[model samples]
Target: MKVVVGIPSFNNAETISHVAKVAAKGIMEFFDGDGMIVNSDGGSSDGTRERFMETDTFGVPKESFVYEGIPGKGSAMKAIMEFSLEQGAQTVVFLDSDLRSVKPWWVERLAGPILRGEADYVTPFYLRHRFDGTITNNVCFPMTSALYGKKVRQPIGGDFGVGKKLLEIYLEKPEETWKTDVARFGIDIWMTTTAINESGRILQAALGTKIHDVKDPGKHLKGMFLQVVGTLFELMVTYQNRWMSVWNIEDVPIYGETPEEEIPPMTIDVDNLKKLAKETLVVPEYVNESAVREVKEDGTLSLNSWVDLLYRSAVQYRKTRDKTVVENLLPFYFARTARFAEEVKSLSDEEAERYVYEQLGVFLERKRLLKEEWEVEDKG
Candidate 1:
């Protein structure tokens, strides 16, 4: 196979060289040094471009390292995909620039299924640290399964391998369809979902170890939620008739059969966590005011608000699978709570907690009921 590895990077100068080296080693093992490394950068102000230009670090040929002019992760991937096709690459694997534990074997493991023709797409399964985002496990995976009838455990996993045919399909599609905010976080989900919808077999390979540095979940909560949920909602609306047919087919597999292994918990800085929480919880006064007014006026929110809620929910969904949009809306939720608190100034602390939780519960219940009805109609 004419394999090519594409690393989509942004300000990852410190880690990019190491990833390049490791990937180089892997490609060298399988192919006779024919493998190439394509770095699709989002105009890194950091020395990421310079680092890649320094040929001593990665033993691969210098001609293989190409920089793209685009700005988003999706754009970066698109650039690499186009370059790979022009280079006559038959198979391509994408690796994130920030991986910490990427071994040479990781590449082979990810691409194994595709080479075997057992699957068209390969996603990574890893032993994640406590603080890692679980949105893939909870929301992205299950929802994908329920909607598309394919059970890919880590639909949004950062690392993936795909064949040339799939790459061509992705490229031929309208750029606007795959190159938006959802594309930023939803690329993997979108890819896996599309592959499944097209009857392309999907597989998950064990990485044996976590690969990337963990970031503050709170900092990413809103963005992740918006990206994931926005992609899903868009899929729901745009492909309503298709997903409606597959909604209750129930062939998607659930994870948890893999044996659990002991791994050290990655420590999260308390100060950082607190800071992230405070920032995330502060709910921009404008977002709250506008969202509330919009909801009250139309009894429905705009696509943007729904996008924001999805992003926030993705963060919470990672922490707890049961989390829904209503559960993740706590930050914006205070707007209504403040009004209720003002109306009943004498309520005790316990009473206030109960009242807010109850209100949230009621809102979520109503949403669930409506969603259930929608699903029923869809399935019908």
Candidate 2:
């Protein structure tokens, strides 16, 4: 089967060359058939395109293009999709251009299942610092498992592989009101949710460890959290019928290497988040000052409180379609996260992951409230 490794990039010049060359080696080493590496750029002012083009591709048909779609990661991916179709590529593996710890073996692990016809989609499984992906640990993984009834740990993890059928499905999706959902950070979760709700043979590849751009959760999370969560709520509407009946999570087979050593202990500055929480507690339309203080002081919220703050905000975003309302949810998120950090500060990483599942049960118990709020009563 023809294979292509696609890297979506923007202002990633510093690391794109290394990622490109390693990915090139990955394709050349793993795929016995025809293969190439394609860099789909989003008009990076940093000259990422030039750097990628200048990199060696071992005589492979590598090409770089400025994407013409929504001008974000998803559009860059769309460019690769178009190219894959044009070249009659049967399989495509996508890697983030900003990845610093990407290894050649990752390509073999991600693409192997697809090439063998064992799966239509492959998601990455990696060793990440406990605090590294707080969003996933707090929201995506648990929420996805409870709602979709399937366990895929890193739904928005950047690297993955897909076959022609799944590629065609993603290409056929129309992004109108929720363009941002399909545009930037929303793209990853959108892709994973699509694979789950729609029919696909999915696999997870254990790609050792991930070491890339790390950002502080309280500061760097607002924009990404808004986009990813907003897109998640939008998809909830689209796939309501499918997940409504999914109560049991189906297991998917995993391939490649799993981490051997214990990842080091990771921690976050809860005091900083607490201070931030105090500032934003009463800021806007959604947050209640009293409630914020109540949740913050105790470093935890009751199940009712959690549902009221998060699920209600999700419902509001879905109904009003106001980006501001989503932004307003930031303070509450800050407060809740601070509380979560305080509660989990003493636990080991494995214990912490399990503790998060208890939080998921609370979400599952309250999901009906969300369904009630999400549905509109029709008048005759």
Query: Where does model 1 exceed 4 Å of error?
Result: 55-59, 62-70, 247-262, 267-372, 375-380
Winning candidate number (TM-score)? 2
Q: Residue 228, candidate 1: how far off, in angstroms?
A: 2.3
Highest lDDT against the true fold, candidate? 2
Output the lDDT of residue 369, model 2.
70
TM-score of 1: 0.69
- Model-by-model lDDT, in order? 0.60, 0.78
- Residue pairs clashing in model 1 are 100-211, 225-310, 225-311, 226-310, 226-311
Mind giving the per-residue lDDT tens digits that candidate 2 earns over 39-84?
9999999999999999987777789989886767888887898899
